[model samples]
Target: MTIMSSTSLSSGLDSVTNKSYLLHFLQLLSTCMAFFLVTRESTWSVDISNWSMFVWCFCFAVTLLTLIAELCGLQDKLHFSWDRFLITSACYCALFCLSAAIIYPIIHLQIFPDGSPRHHVIAATAFSCIASVAYAVEVVWTCARTGEPSCSLLGLLKRLEIFVACVIFAFLSNTYPSERQPALVWCVAVYCICFILGAVAMLRHRCDCDESLPYSCLGFGQSVLAVLLYTTALVLWPLYQFNGDFGGQPQRSNELSCIDELTSYLCVWDQRLVVAILTAVNLLIYVADLVILTVVSDRGSTQGLRIPSSY
Candidate 1:
């Protein structure tokens, strides 16, 4: 496996698929938990009638862009060619934004009342979707072509991809299929399913690679933390989903004598606060990720030159 030429330097980048997949899964899970918690606290109305559709649309568009990048493979070196990277990245970004425009209305984000400040919803939803798609594409593309062979562990990436798929499916199951109780149930199902899938995928890969554990990590550890945060969000979001299930039940609300057991559970545990805390923590983690990526880039200069670390 020894490298004989500079031509093989691109193998280290694991491409855009798995890394982007993990980041998006975590990002969405955070927002979902945040919205769930705020609504429970009676502090904010987390509107998603318009927001959810854009998320859905962006997911599809990114799926296509990542797949394409994965197939073509991009330049991966300590210093990438900015001109080519910018052009390709912009092309990929356009797809995500354009597709979301058509998809938002299909999922009932348009259900918001007329002339009641849909602009924020529109702008936020569109911006979030675009950034999400861009991040996934960029990271994945970077990984696939980089010289760091250790980052290409199939075991790691597969788990992340499965996690993202679970989130997408969980959201879809709520609308297209039958209505299920405890919106939290869907969130829980996604978390458990993704956790299981990732665990199995990692185990299946049987990676023998090793890296030192310290106060800092290279790229792979960052991906692991991202998945873990996503799992935490999934567990936390159930609190709010259950609230939605109970609140939406008009027939049960009318009949006080035969109160639903689930409603009793929601009343006892305020779902809003739980979701808000989870969302806040997840956002904090998201910020941490940006910091981690920046730090790694800063260290890139010392990479092949074998400069000693203060750590």
Candidate 2:
């Protein structure tokens, strides 16, 4: 038993030298640097800095935990497919870091005094960007590899759907669109429901429990529902937010509250516009997801019909 344990440990160590493992290492390192740089500075006073810190810290902790699991061969013992989990983690971390990379500089750089503090924030942003790229590369690399169980084109689309929903939430948070109109409340609900469904679907697939569920049918139904929900948001968001008849600001206001020249942060009008655009984008993604799910489901049913005669 001791000898067997020694061999397992040795193999796990050797596995770290692979190219795939190297990407994980890079992610871990970059996130660590970003987190360290941000926390070392006194930027916690900024509200946005807290969000940025959460991104870096979350990514760093998850990546470190993933690496430890890999090195300890925990994947072999776990019920869920570790490879699939890794791909999912990579996709989310990439999007999270990318948001931080964009938002941190815009918010923090403008508020900070020009000196060492700004430089630290700059360095942190750079590392966040690096980590984002590294995780993205990891996903692309995994997808490109053949004979991988959970690496499907549909998987990438699912991730995009979730990420877009997240971005919409971020935009809505800044402007509080739901507070503006009752219609917008339903839009927020759509985002939340669809986001939760997408997350559950991904988790189910990763856990290898998809076989027990009507995955294709569920995906098709979810796609159709998401498309319909987002379509409502896409129309109502712009109508209520941009129409003069609805008491909405039709254009960018000269009001001081609407403009912040220093941070170049998005104004209320701009945020609403962004939410509208993202709603449209998510609608398109769901449309595409529906189409693909339809095709795949049809092919599956056809294949099922043909399998009985071969025996």
Candidate 3:
């Protein structure tokens, strides 16, 4: 009976190990394919900004490194370390950015000249949809495994926000192509505000510190960077627009006018107006994240210093 039991246990362990290896292999393969697609797309146009291409390449590289680390079983060694958290966060951000990039161009295809190829738009839309779904599923699985209240809730909310944004963009693209830009701009502003509010709530009632979990400092820094970038973009857009730098004939005048004088005046500068609103929201979000990081860090340090009583 002992021999039989031992044999069965050994067989079970082997089976589990084999399955793990297979899963890792598949992940590695998928990462490689994603990397290839992004790289190939980057090389297609010389007119494209180098910085944008570099960002995409960097994201894919980070993702590939993460997959390699997992396949080599190094994740077990560095699982709770900052290195692991950084890599995982980078992969998530990269994937999000890549998916956004794909979807953005497709949804705003009308913004481009008619001479541009249409095939790429269709391809990008398909890929972005597939990738977004996959990412959403991964988030659900992670939430299930971790069950960290604050983090899991945040992840779920972020996924929902992204999905909703995609849906709204799609609808705007199909139904109100002429108004899509302003609509999207407003959507972004609202999203930033909502995100800030959610972050505040989460930080106020964060779950207990988990050593293996990623630090909030990373998010704080990202928020700051986002604020800066959006502010700069907002400032530059007006300058470029007023300077007539976006060459091609000026926008045709609209005979339709609002009944209210203030509304009509605001409509004339819609682009700048939306950007300014977005920038303000981003700034608020940045401040909220900064506070969250400071509070969490202080709490973590205090917990570390507490001494347990002996019975």
Candidate 4:
């Protein structure tokens, strides 16, 4: 048997803890910066801006709470109970779907116009696609790890809600710009109601569990649907552009005007740069999660090892 000195063990733990904290801090910083840039530079409609703000804010809150929990050594307390985790994850999954819907048109229309030499439009589009995949993976991972039926059920409901929202948005995009706002607002309101209903149901049936197999299948279905919808939107985006059906007219001139006046701050930035940074940060977080999961699984397996009684 090999032994580690107490000091060496403690030092190793400290190194791991510090690395975790650094990653969290970087996530918080990148998210905040991206939010700031989007708020200032996004030339999309007010509805899209509002939705983007909501996503950035949600990310900010999660990261902040996680950082505080880590520093305070209160991670266990901060862990979402299985039910809460399902509900929260469902909500985020829905939000990501909505994001993909909104971003698709924006990228195709060049709403934020990639003036940067780095081809920000392609980067932004790539990030949006990757982010959607990340969200889907998160939903499925949560369900699989918890073996919770409600998790998959709630995810299904949210995915359907997002699918309907995207369809409506696609239809509206073909309509006159002046007429789309009210319809979009109403659609958002209805989805919000549905989301709330799902949450309440989750709360009411916290202890409920059906066989995991059906829900696992449903979870897989939901993920596939999400990827399909997002990719479909991406493919349809260029068609919308070519047909001149992306809103009433291009707002590129107005966006350029806004950028010119922001010589002090946002002028130097473009959506792609912000998006690339956010994507990197999200990838880091995903990698960190995988590492943590591996460590936990290894420790559990080690603890389970036992000599045969016959020996």
* Overall lDDT per candidate, in order of appearance: 0.40, 0.74, 0.42, 0.42
Q: How would you encode candidate 3's per-residue C-alpha lDDT over 1-311 as one tens digit per residue?
A: 99999999999868755643453344434444443454554423321222233434454465466657755878677635433243234335435545455534533353333543434444444454454344334334433433433232223333333333333322222122134345334444554554554344334433222231225555556545545654554554444433355421134243132233423432334423344454454445445544544555666633332222210
The regions of model 4 sitting more than 4 angstroms off are 1-30, 40-46, 78-87, 90-108, 112-114, 117-155, 158-193, 205-311
lDDT of 2 by residue, 274-302 (tens): 78888888898888767766766656532
**Clashing residue pairs in candidate 4, if any?**
none
C-alpha lDDT (0 to 100) for residue 106 of candidate 1: 31
Clashes in model 2: which pairs? none
Candidate 1 clash total? 21
lDDT over C-alpha atoms for residue 286 of model 2: 84
TM-score of 4: 0.42
Candidate 2's C-alpha runs over 4 A off are: 1-22, 43-50, 110-114, 141-146, 178-180, 207-215, 254-256, 260-264, 301-311
Model 1: per-residue lDDT, tens digit, 96-167? 343343333333233344443344445444554554555445444444444332232221233234433433
> Quick one: best lDDT, which candidate?
2
lDDT of 4: 0.42
Candidate 3 lDDT at 13 equals: 66
Which is superior by TM-score, 3 or 4? 3
Worst 10 residues of 3 by lDDT: 302-311
- Winning model by TM-score: 2
